[model samples]
Target: MKRAQHFIGVAVAAAAVIGVTSLVGNDYYLRIIFMMCVYYLCAAGMNVLVGFAGQKSLGQAGLFAAGAYAVALLTTKTEISPWLALIAAAAISGVCGVLIALPSLRVKGPYLAMVTLAFGIVVEKLVGEWTEVFGGAQGIYGIRPITWNDQPLTSQQWVWFAVVLCALAHLLLRNLLQGRFGRALLSLQADEIASASVGVRVYRAKVIAFVVAAVTCGIAGALVAQQNQYINSDFITFHLSIFILLLVLFGGAGSMYGPLIGAVILTAVDAALARWPSAQHFLYGFLLLFALYVMPGGVAGVFRALFKERTETEAGEKSEEPPKTTRIGPAGEGELLAVEGVTKAYGGVKPAQNVSFRLQRGHIHALIGPNGAGKSTMINMLTGVVKPTSGSIRFLGQEIAGKPAHLICSMGMGRTFQNLRLFSDLSVLDNVMLGRHTRMRNGFFSSLMGLPVAGRQEAVTRGRALELLELVGLAHLAHQPAGSLPYGLQRRAELARALATEPQLLLLDEPAAGLNPHETAELGQQLLRIGRCGVSILMVEHHMDLVMSVSDHVIVLDYGIKIAEGKPAEVQCNPRVIEAYLGVDDEDDIEARETCPPSEGRRDAET
Candidate 1:
């Protein structure tokens, strides 16, 4: 059904372009189409970074200007061919993007946004101040028009060419979004910690996203310069950057068609309103408000809502199945994880001090401690999210103490966070598919072209994700938005996502935290089942009942120091454990005393 819908949509888009081009040869409409194509390319690129990769960049127009100016200067002043200039423009912009992204990667949220905005301002100022090179405020003029051979191309012909190019780029982006790189980006966006734990290089993915967006914006800028035949710094101003961002948001950030829809609607409205003069700005603001309030998910989300109507109506008819649990059979004796004197300190506070533990193959090891006892810190150190101050961690006989999270994950160690970190906006199925990124071997070209190997790998990964979801009892919610699931179910989905990485050792942090008594019991059963599947489990849990029942070995920590280690019952009776919980005097009293005061003493006290 989805494939059929895609085919129909493509056919409709092709027919519309052809019909509109043939019937509307007027200069005004042709210009509108050209603007749409330019915006489409820019927004699509922005979406790759912001939507798919989950990085907020506000310097898109700066990059666009860089590309346009590069092309304009090269073609007009340097006597370079227009085609060569376009290529050079894209290359230059791509390089600038990498530079900008390098600094921005160190910051996140508003900081990153501010930095990118500053970059745009800097670029604009540079263009305005460099009079000899950039023509200052007057900008460059008399730009030679593009031509095929000796004959100049008509405006209609340019529009047609742009339409074809933009369409092809869109198709390529759509394929990229469905492949391994796309999955890795989504994974990083969803949960960077979990993504790294599953072998995704978070920084590399962010860089790729930024570069891809910049390259696309560069192409769009070149096209715009050619279309206008007069290039200026004003063409890629701060307002243009904001406008492109607005388009992405107003059209739905993650959807493939969002930017195109947003570009067409906003541009058409703006163009029509321009004729009104007095009421134009006011009308445009009103329409924007209306769109924001009425369709917050943007135009693409509106279409999705309509498409899912029938599926939502028939949701009650879906099948029911038992929740799947991780289960591994016994394996030959081999060490899965070995941590030797792992120590981590934050400023002056020690969270993990000389914590040493070893996990064997097919065993469920429990690390239990009170709040702030360094349990989570130890897990972070093991997974490379936090570097240990001292000590070494060996997984499968290889030292991985200071390795990055993604590298650690690629080595077959997967972990979940204490808090639920599922990608709220992505569907459950996509969330699981992200876990398979480390195992996928296809590159950007293979994915964009939909090579045979890429297709087969994608199919296998999808099936694996589905199976893992079934194991975690979220198969029924595969198509549902992950954020919409109930808390317990979301936790289960997190586990499913981790298992999708096919890790040899799984680290579960507080997996049973929010579950009820019955749910905790079920989770305990699931942990044992996972151990039976040959996947060594290291669980950090506060639920004593679940931990005691499921753990093959229990290690207790108090104030960053290991006080007791043994079977669950044995550790529960340790004097140090009792002292940590109920104090030393209370432990002695519990061992020495049996009953309370007598009735006579009570009567005398009453008197």
Candidate 2:
């Protein structure tokens, strides 16, 4: 019902704008309206890159040029329809977007910005200096304009076309951004490692964002070239790129209405500055700086702050219902994970050396060691955060020694970080939903079009995530931002997120870190419950009580080497285990009197 209302509101607004344009019938006003729509198209796509995916690009102008020139050449030199030429131009520019995104895989921040900037400069030079194909400064002429019923559109008609196109773009983009696809992009922006650990393909998501930006910018360029019936090197410039960026940043890069808000206001500001070209760039510079330092979230952000969404707080809640633990993974045949001589080394430093272990399904195994014992390093290797120096790791009888983190996660291994790596800005429910990303069946087109299947799948995933939160005793806080929760709650939220992956083998790194005794006890029980539900657990913890109480089996490591492994009680009483925690005295240190008491040594180990 709310969705229907949203579309109806948009339709009514669009109709009013078109009605107003027809009534005014002024050439200058029509031109501004047309350009506003065109710039909105450009800014809409750029927002996916710079806002949602957190990849800053400055070469969008090159993509714009690709579309503009493709349309010009196709219409003036060939017999293809002008509309078909527009489609082709968008495809070409999308390919260019892929090429631009390749650098993002290796470089980021200013380095990526420079790479894209260089691409724009190269395209600008080619169009300006290459006379034969591009027409040099003379530019391409006689470009065919779009027509309806075999007649060229009038100025008012053109404005209407642009308005319709912008509306469709906004609607389609909103559909894509409000679902799993949108969540994946936002996840990328938050933390790539955490995103991948939840099964989001980092590079693929980046490329898709770039392509969205490129396609829209390209179409906007094509629209301009076709409408004017001419194109030139001057149309594609660094200033144009900067202006396009300003449209997103000044309007609110990530907000749904940011592009429209930016396009209307900034285009008007540009028109106001048109009389004095000398001062235009200077003022634009000032606005960009101001937006960066002051209005960082843009106009949309300010509006959001003024009309903040009401939320339910947990302040007055005395207690939550008892957790209903859910069934986790399928029954396992035998070994869930086997590590054979897995070693990770950095120059002279070896965090894991010739370590081997096998985790059985439906059991809780704890890896405990003092500080610097490589327990976390082993977890990292298993989850593909770090590549092993040598040896094999088999999960579900499949070799996964060097798989990508996301692929490793998809292959039935889920993990949490030693330090919290929650997508803090997202709601706790959304963070957990990201873990279900790999299991989702809907693809890009289905999500983009807001198909019924996509909605159903999203609803189902949300339900499952909420269930996972309940299992971890956090359903009451599902709607709250993950970062806003208290530290102990955040730990539970992260656990819920990892479990949403439905892993056969769950690897937890210091899951009880920073938790008080009561919280730690609850976490131990949660692990036991999860293990009973048929999921194997590999836990790295410094909390001795939690480990000894809940763990069925125990492994001990010291100075990058596995020293012992057995049943918890048997291993706890082992002489080597005691010695590793409390060093023995030699003849040279015989002045140390009697050996330290066993209770004191155990306390020292726990600390």
Q: Which candidate is the best by TM-score?
A: 2
Clashing pairs in 1: 324-471, 326-529, 326-530, 327-529, 327-533, 328-532, 328-533, 328-534, 329-532, 329-533
- In candidate 1, what residue range of length 10 has the lowest lDDT sum? 598-607
User: For each candidate, C-alpha RMSD in Å?
Assistant: 5.5, 2.4
lDDT by residue for model 1 (144-176), tens = 667898665688878877887787787778778
RMSD of 1: 5.5
TM-score of each: 0.90, 0.96
Question: Each candidate: how many clashes?
Answer: 10, 0
- Model 2 deviation from the true structure expressed as Cα RMSD, one decimal place: 2.4
Per-residue error for 571 in candidate 2, Å, reads 1.7
Off by over 4 Å in 2: 315-319, 587-604
Please give the lDDT score at residue 325 for candidate 1.
54
